[model samples]
Target: MSRVRLLFLSLVFLVAGSVQADVVNKNVDTAVDISTQLVKIAHKVTVENVGKTPVKSLIFGVPAHIKERLSFISAKVGEHQLRLSETKVDNQEGGFWKLELRSDITAGRTLPLSIDLVLGRGLIPHPSQITQKEKQLVLFEGNAYYFSPYLTEKQTLTVNLGTSSVESFARVQPVSQSDTKITYGPYEKVAPFKEERLNIHYENNSPFLTITKLERVIEVSHWGNIAVEETIDMEHQGATLKGPFSRYEYQRETQSGIASVKSFRTALPASAVDVYYRDDIGNISTSHMRVLSDSVELELRPRFPLFGGWKTHYTLGYNVPSYEYLFNQGDQFVLKMRLMDHVVDDMYVEELTTKIILPEGCHSIELTAPYSVKRLKDTLHQTYLDTKGRPVVSVSKSNLVENHIDDFELRYTFAKVLMFQEPLLVIFAFFALFLLVIIYVRLDFSITDEEENSRVEREQKDK
Candidate 1:
């Protein structure tokens, strides 16, 4: 071979090698602030080919466990497609992708890709089937993907690639970790816990699931036997339960299941006398109630087995004996009670509402709450011939979760005499008007002396 030809062939081989080489890069951004229950995440990826030959197709992979928490997936550049493929060794599912160039060209170009993350407990639907018959109250929802209770806050989330050339950019920090608490970043770090951290795998079987906490407070009045009710709702925000679930599998798991992403139990206040729990279709027979002298506890089991992505609703009510709440405290009647229990340990409030009802004759009302209230309004509610209608106060707050419950308080006072003062005022006003008309008639002088004489003469002549 000629020397020139040999040199040209060697050069061509070297160029071809560069176009076929594989390159991968990754970057991650995360924000954690429990005060709002929202966590934001962004991920960027880049891939290139360094080999000499033009590559027709290339596949990029992601963790198999991430399928459940991914709210959405799309490519930043190139007409690429994502698919779920089974790994041959474990038969477990993994994310697969295929990318093709619009037009084949020389080797040295890079492909940039991006994916966004909105992670938390899961999604909760509005006007949910669970609360169709009752009012809807939502307290907090978090957005974080792949939350592992077992993971120490210090352990950084690390994404791995087989090749060393693949680069990554990630920013992670600790929030809180202790015996009674476990939290993540955008905040200060805390100590570790003594109890085992719970672990939840990313299983994409459903669309949404919610974690809710409800509390109902009833105040008893001796004279009127009044009952006051309040409720709070909180949900888990992250991934949802996907696909149609198998009843057989659900039942089997119920008997021996140790881990669940959707089941929760609620405890009622001790003073509750009669309790009822139901969803859209009506009464759910699965619930059981136990009444103790000091308090009552009700166990509620949803009609359909609640799993991820599925929803259920329940309403609870109990009667209070009269005179328990109507008594006067230093010439002013005081009404107070705690409305809810078991707010998630780490959850904060996005919104809160409190309604207070005052008895008749109660006036000149004064009120206060332990937490900050964004808005307050007073309205009249007429019931049972209340002459001096009852006062109803409504309060609303935002960015609140479970930890702020202890700071909640509501107080109000009204005049005791106004209860009957309004009725008495109405009655006296009517009688006063009647007496004034009678007095005016008696004071009028109708006939003068001359007019009377003329009338008498006319009468005598006619006779």
Candidate 2:
């Protein structure tokens, strides 16, 4: 038997022996935040096991219609986060996920669970196009009841629109509106797989900027520097501008373009230095930077105001001290950095690709991401004084929100002596050049000694 076959059999048995449980949601309270472009949902669930056996894990689900809008989801018990994996439940087709609890719950026992979800592209512009003076209104459609596999004994939902200027909302029974918040049902004994469309149409004049594409490159140097550069392509995904833009009218009215984006703030590390923000034209001097105690805040303003459907592209870069993110103890080095940093508040990123370039002569590379990301094939990148080229690890993800901002760790092995490789190469090149010069001066290149003596005689005569 080959080792490969043996390992395959081991994995098959390991999965077959896993535990399954039957649990019910005793009570659920959900809150939806639609103040900005992104939709944030938080659920506080009280779960109880109804089966005779112990329940080691629980399954959570999202409706198939809106599954593509979900960008991030997490379940926590107390302060500890549980591990969730995508799985398929029998006779069901949706975004089904299973999470293992910290400890198993016996029959008739209860446990409290906290689940949070960040959804992108959830709020869509109602009219899809508007003039400069009109307020931006969006429509949000979601489930009225908690979408769960098991029967929910009691559940309630609250929608916070963060604005009192409302248009219309779904009139589900036992629903009330108070200021910017809408409350729905303390309904009882909800059946499994039940869904009721909840719609809210309201005014949201917030900036609806979205990053269509982002390419982040992090280059590491053993000489105590780590350089990061991000190329961003941004688009205003809100209502499209209907008429021609009028700069003079926009300047006259203070609230001419309420939904138009003029500027946004970006945060960097406290130790970040030599920061630059530029575009294809050249440096943009309209930006401002303020150094805070915990971070460096940069206010980026494009050349023109970003109206609906307008687009802009820029490149932002900075350098941080290697000691802050890179750590090494006797050869093995670990680099901890953010997978995706903050682009703007409540920002939605359509596509994100991150690349990390390690120093030359590094080997035994390992990567640990906070969430699942599609890892691309590793390649080599050659730069100045690079002999064998640096190893570049690339990973990509889509539909990312602000909640996805977290650290990813990379580990690699590099001998301390390899740090001197570039300096040594420089020294050897100079030494070889000097040796060649010495040999060239001493060599008698004349075809004959008579020709050499005649050249010397001509030089003396001229003098």
Candidate 3:
């Protein structure tokens, strides 16, 4: 073949691929929440199924570099969880995750999906550093479209910023910049395998919060109470202070609740009581609990303000009536509760450990999570009067996003007979101990025989 002919053929093939790659993005309602630590994005997208056979899966491309730090929290079609797998887009080749539908979408039908995306290390500080008093500026970059191997038709992008004062942003022809948000393109028939870059530098003085480690313990008691406790080691992942922090300046800013993590708040189930907050230095007195009609709001202040690159560790706990979370279905007991419940805002957890401790003598256990779990193990836990010890189900995961929180279903069987086993054993043990004491006192040795004979004579005369 001639060189000119070969080049012309390659060009023709590329044009054909681009022309066929477009997918109708019927409508996309995108929400970006950048007010808190992590930048959370959600898309309620409706797309047309173009293939002749039923389309069972969708291939969506993501920035491969940030894919590791990104949390693909939930992808739902209607009300069911969508299964995801790594695959290539057949029509347009790219690295993408295939979202498998629970039910196939017939050709020429529309499939609506809700996807949750969290960027873990989303905010990059602009100056590569900052001073203690200087406000933090974050540089964030993202593709205008939801990086799909297929080109989008009539897609719109809406972005939310951490601060209303957006210092700088990249300008695109079809994009409009607002105070705290930017919206780009409802363009029709966009070519495939293309990227329209979007960049923003915004004023976000908030502490980029991350939980280094989180340990949550859920204790299920057949005795009418469910207790939950979570230990958290939180760190400010924002720009680090160049020098030693100025206490005076930080106090002024922190006292005003500006650019400092002096306190944090989260909600608890209204029935939750016996609330407690503590750190390594014992109980934190600067915490408050407000009981609302629907839920209890807990606000806890750490020992000191958390600045950039600073860390603090604490634990919060509460108790709920067992009837609220535990349900009895014939011979089996089921527990429905949030795995870690809630942490601070826009939270990113590096490592999280959740342990469900069932009552003593529980066996035949089953554990299920709505989200992905890294490691799961079953073991025996020993406590007071625990003869055979209680059963424990421990599950650990990493890179947890706040909105990714979901309920964990745990089902187990606890025999009614085992409920009384511990009490009976305790009674038997005490009774045997009492008998041994009596037997020891009754034994006679040497001089004790005279006293026994005298007592016997007195008893016989009285009779």
> Each prediction's Cα lDDT score?
0.41, 0.89, 0.75
Best by lDDT, which number?
Answer: 2
- Which model, 2 or 3, shows the larger TM-score? 2
The 10-residue segment with the lowest total lDDT in model 1: 187-196
| Stretches > 4 Å off in candidate 1 | 1-226, 230-238, 253-263, 291-295, 320-327, 343-350, 407-463
Ranking by lDDT: 2, 3, 1
How does candidate 1 fare on TM-score?
0.43
Model 2 lDDT, full chain set: 0.89
* Per-residue accuracy of model 2 over 93-129 as CA lDDT, tens digit each: 5688899888999987999999999889889998899
Tens digits of per-residue lDDT, candidate 3, 1-463, equal 4334433433433444332222344566777666666777788888775546676566556665447558655688878888877655445543466787777777678888898788888778776567766777888776666665444455777888845888877776687867777777766554445666667788887767789999999988887999999998999877776767677877666433255577888888899989999888899899888999998988878888777778998888989999988998776999999987777766788899999999987778888888778656688889888877888899998887776678988888877777787788899999999999999999865677778999999999999
What ordering of candidates by TM-score runs from best to worst? 2, 3, 1
Model 2, stretches more than 4 Å misplaced? 1-22, 432-463
Better of 1 and 3 by TM-score: 3
TM, every model: 0.43, 0.89, 0.85
TM-score of 3: 0.85
Please tell me which model should have the higher lDDT, number 2 or number 3: 2
